[model samples]
Target: DRVRIFSRRLTDVTDSIPEMVDYAKTKVKASEFLIEGEVIALGEGGKPVPFQDLMRRFRRVHGVEDMVEKIPLRLYLFDVLQCDGKTLIDLPYTERWEILASLAPTESLAPRIMTRDPKVVNDFMQAALKEGHEGLMAKSLTSDYAPGARGKKWFKIKPSDRLDVVIVAADWGSGRRVGWLSNYHLAVRDDTTGEYLVVGKTFKGLTDAEFDMITKRLQELKIRESKWTVHVKPEIVVEVAHNEIQKSPRYKSGFALRFARIAKFRDDKTPEEADTIQRLRKLYEKQFENKGRLLKEVP
Candidate 1:
């Protein structure tokens, strides 16, 4: 029996299963379907719920009924890949939408339609940023569904507010950084010239657990050793937050990143796909002009 149903991340449901069951009964056909959505927690005034609360829901395999009463969730559906015995992967996004829209009722349990219009997408991204969402995803309407494939068919536009860079080299930990592979040197690619240039470094954002996991992975990928640095295969991509960019002679590109902090490790991204030096130059220009305006306003 190939029944179709929608599934969301455990954290997204604000109501119990009984309530969702009732909602689903009215909204969907009695057939079996598997729908995917994100489960987020909501805060006061209809704000997105915290990740921690969502984690609790994920850990609860038993007592779901009781847990639902305690921890509510919000589901944001994005796609309908399969329905009954038919595969929606061969269908264009527009066709998929027709089936989904006709079948699924847009209520508290409904998922929002993701689009590719840059201007409209940008506006929605800004709203997501203000609402504390990590960022937005852009999918091409002509692309077929490719499960487990990191294809360009679905392009993610994460707030351009941060850079995902590769760890090219790392220095030995010292003092507090001792016993761990800290003090990283990050780099970005030159898409036009096929080169990598150092942009910044940081030793933050890794928990003890993360430290252990990354250290083990880094050691496995180690290629060469230097006096103060270990040159490893550039296999790790990390998201970084920065105050601004500046021109500098210390790096090959005549530029450097300032006040950089680790945001996250991007295991999904490849080193070759890291941001380019040209992109950095553009970002630096905007950051520099913004700083000048701030300085002028200061007393």
Candidate 2:
């Protein structure tokens, strides 16, 4: 009895009818149900297409059948809230899992199972990391499914790999960072030459307290001013994390950081002890090699 159904990713109305009708026949007797799943497009060799490519498939409505054939999908379902004439909101997660497990089809049309077991979850998380995924998500088994709630029941674990580097210069801040210098030009030491190589710049992850403290400290250490960047004494050490590394001409080191964000300020570390440019290059290469092996094992 689905009077209306809407999906952002799904386009094949004919293919979806049987599945929806079957779910309606078996899972619902009086009340309606709303289900959600991630519809991911697959690449030429059955790999997941990039998010941008998925966006293209999501926009076509008149040529939906052609779009479905050109860009296939893999649906990953996680939760269910309503079934039949009863609301499952009051039920514990275990009860919902039992019902879901029993009713869920196991053929090509079924959604992959998601679990909360620490060991199993950890394994999936590690695999995702090795496959270059953003991060892992952990959910409490006892928690109820609350739509649109950013509760403590769910937690996201991102890779905390960071490089401690020295700050060479600062940029004038605007708006909130006006007057005081806030954004930093970071660099890594060159072990052989004892020189610093400009690697990246970042202005994120600073708390209000940290912003005030850093601005005051930078003002004291400012030696000279340049057209775009302000020269400062190499005294502050900051740790940053990034998704990947890429070669760039902007930095003298021949490489630039990508998606870098501040982890913390290393008050205990000196500029002499900061990570070297060579070491950062080695780490990036190692991660790339490890990711290659992970993609082969996923299928």
Candidate 3:
């Protein structure tokens, strides 16, 4: 039996994760089945690894077995849309969960609880964080699976890691942001070399007013400029929030910040007082105390 795993935009990524396909073929009871689930890379003691590890595993085309042995995967099925050639999308969330439970092994199902108590929800959220998960998804029991529409049927609750980084450069903006250096190049300092290592970039979490103000300050601190990007003196510091730090060859520091955005300006701190590359490295290394070498594909 053949199974297909389509990800965002319905892209066929089946070959990238043959292990999941194999599990679905042998473990899942349905002849024709469609399920919605989360697949995270597993680390030591079966704790979840950083999201970057999962991403690298998803991109493998060759040497997949090596990667698989390094970073095994675990799936948590939460919904089922089809089973045995019958459609189940019309079913409510709770009903679909029941169907999924019957088809998937108990250990393959997501940790489930039915409760309206805020204290219970809060405690569950804390537990998810402790398990190295981003957060929890709260789905309405009566709602149907509405594909491609993120309208209130489920709510995602996540907490981000924040760091104070300096702007080393900025690119010119287009469209409505034209005439403003809206996109920022964010970086952290290497204490040993006194160099600024770029971690990521973003044009988010800032208002037009704030953008205008920062543009003026950055232009004043400008040390050099090119056609599209203006390299600055790294004097302007700001607090930045991101989902995770990934091992990346794109930067000299071999680190990239995922989904980075400006949180707020840090006028109270000087560039010299900003967070350092060593701090980012510590967080990256902590993503796998014993498993990153085995599981993480360096990219």
- TM-score of each prediction: 0.49, 0.56, 0.88
Error of 1 at 293 (Å): 35
- Candidate 1 lDDT over 1-299, as tens digits, reads 32223333234333334445554566665275656556565544455543444555556556777666555656565667777778787888778767776667666334344655778777887777666565676667777778767398787665336898988888878787677778788899899887778887788777877777777777788999887778788889999986456667789977777667788988889888888898998986654322221111111
The per-model lDDT (C-alpha) reads 0.67, 0.67, 0.86
The alpha-carbon deviation from the true structure for residue 115 of candidate 2, after best TM-score superposition, in angstroms, is 2.3
Which residue runs does candidate 1 get wrong by more than 4 Å? 1-26, 108-117, 160-239, 242-299
Per-model tally of clashing residue pairs: 18, 0, 2
- Write model 3 residue lDDT over 1-299, tens digit each, in one string: 98999875687778888899999999998899989888888876788877766877777888888777887888888889899988888789888888888898999999977899999999998888777777888888898988887478888887788999999999989999998999999999999999999988899999999889988988998999999999999898999998778878898878888889999999999999999999998887775543333334454
* Number of the predicted model whose lDDT against the real structure is largest: 3
Deviation of model 2 at 84, angstroms = 23
Residue-by-residue lDDT tens digits, candidate 2, 1-299 = 44443454334443432334455457543455555445555554455544545555555546555665666665544556776666786566667656665555543233223774778877877776655455665666787877666389777777767889988888988897786667888899999998999888888888878878988888788889886568889899999987666667788998777777788999999999999988988986775443332122120
Shift of residue 133 alpha carbon in model 2, Å: 3.0
Better of 1 and 3 by lDDT: 3
Higher-lDDT candidate of 2 and 3: 3
